[model samples]
Target: MLDLPPDLPRLRTLRTWHEQCLREIDRAIAAAEEQARAEQQAQERRAAATPPPWMVGLQDITGTPEELHQGGCTMWAHRRRKTVTRDQARELLAAGIRACEFCKPDAELGFL
Candidate 1:
């Protein structure tokens, strides 16, 4: 770094520009945080809605395809879910869609 002259007036202007850049960065960060919160609220609303009766269980990489859980089953919280109509549920079960033992969706569908 080069030594500046003692009477250099550029120092004040540079400091002002730096502060303006910092303020803009802070505003952008706040906007991003607000957007994230809004998205989270929307997701929560979707989760609160009543789930369909027949659900398909989500499969994870390298894991077996587990049985589908009932809509109101507590185990649904830990897995991803897909909603299915009553008839579709029956068809799925008939086609070898396994039912969760805890929720026993097959029994709920009169299959068991």
Candidate 2:
């Protein structure tokens, strides 16, 4: 409970005080929204700068590694995929996993 000023003895003065409080609350809300927007932009920038280099597409039924793709490839249709390192992607390709025809991760990794 905030202590009101003892001098707000008139209705007009009380209404003015209420309006001032509301304006202060509005300012606080605006500041919070601005901060949230700035934080979200920073997070988006970070995500864009450090994307995974490779990914392994997985089989829907067995969850086994099915295809290799560059991290930015979108041609993979499987919902199950795993982020992998460049070396891991090469190893998986060498171990008989198929490379995505569209993305051609094997060629990208110099495997072909």
Candidate 3:
């Protein structure tokens, strides 16, 4: 006749160890997943708080409206009267130089 299982104690011990290992692995995976979620949330919060263009303390106020367009209209129609050529304005704006508050570079459509 064929021999049956020798001892059930060894089988129970093996099962217990296997179950313990599986539980530990599950805990580790859960912890990793939680950490990943936290990291992703933090990144999202940072992205939302930060500006789109990674600029410092300014909105993307690029270009101006067309209300001041005329043949003989004066340029730089803000509190301050600083005027620059279209090329110069483009260069300055491209260099991340914000418009002068008084002059209101963003309020000029001639350069646009």
Candidate 4:
């Protein structure tokens, strides 16, 4: 610990000034962080609005080139998705859709 001189008023004034300076520094740091966050959010929003080229069907889901084949029942090959689940596959097969042999919709074949 540091000891202050016997001047009580001067010591109090110094402490007050030190506290005020600390508050100002904190506020400046907070403002900078907020601006950075806002810019990052704006970039994200722009990216979401534009979307990628692969995404042609769903919101962000892309279709595979082999979707033209796989003649089965439900027409699963026609609809492309970002993530294909086991249940979705079954549903498509049950509906008369078939999986693409060349593209292999299950694996990473036609996925752009």
CA lDDT of every candidate: 0.79, 0.87, 0.51, 0.52
Per-model TM-score versus the true fold: 0.50, 0.60, 0.45, 0.44
Put down candidate 3 lDDT per residue, 1-112, tens digits, no spaces.
9544579997788779989999999999999999999999999998776422111122225343222112122333332223345555555566656544444544553343
Clashes of 3: 0
lDDT of 2 at 7: 68
TM-score, cand. 3 vs. native: 0.45
Residue pairs clashing in model 3 are none
Q: Candidate 4 lDDT, tens digit per residue, 11-106? A: 999899999999999999999999999999999998776522221122224443233222232334346533334455444444545445454543
Ranking by TM-score: 2, 1, 3, 4
Give the winner by lDDT. 2
| Per-residue alpha-carbon lDDT of candidate 1 for residues 17-110, written as tens digits (9 for 90 to 100) | 8899999999999999999999999999988886766677767664444567778888868776677788878887888878888989888889
Ten residues in sequence with the least summed lDDT for candidate 2? 2-11
Q: Itemize residue pairs with steric clashes in candidate 1.
A: none
Model 3 lDDT vs. the true structure? 0.51
What is the Å distance of residue 71 in model 3 from its true position?
A: 32
TM-score for candidate 2: 0.60
User: Which residue runs does candidate 1 get wrong by more than 4 Å?
Assistant: 1-48, 62-65
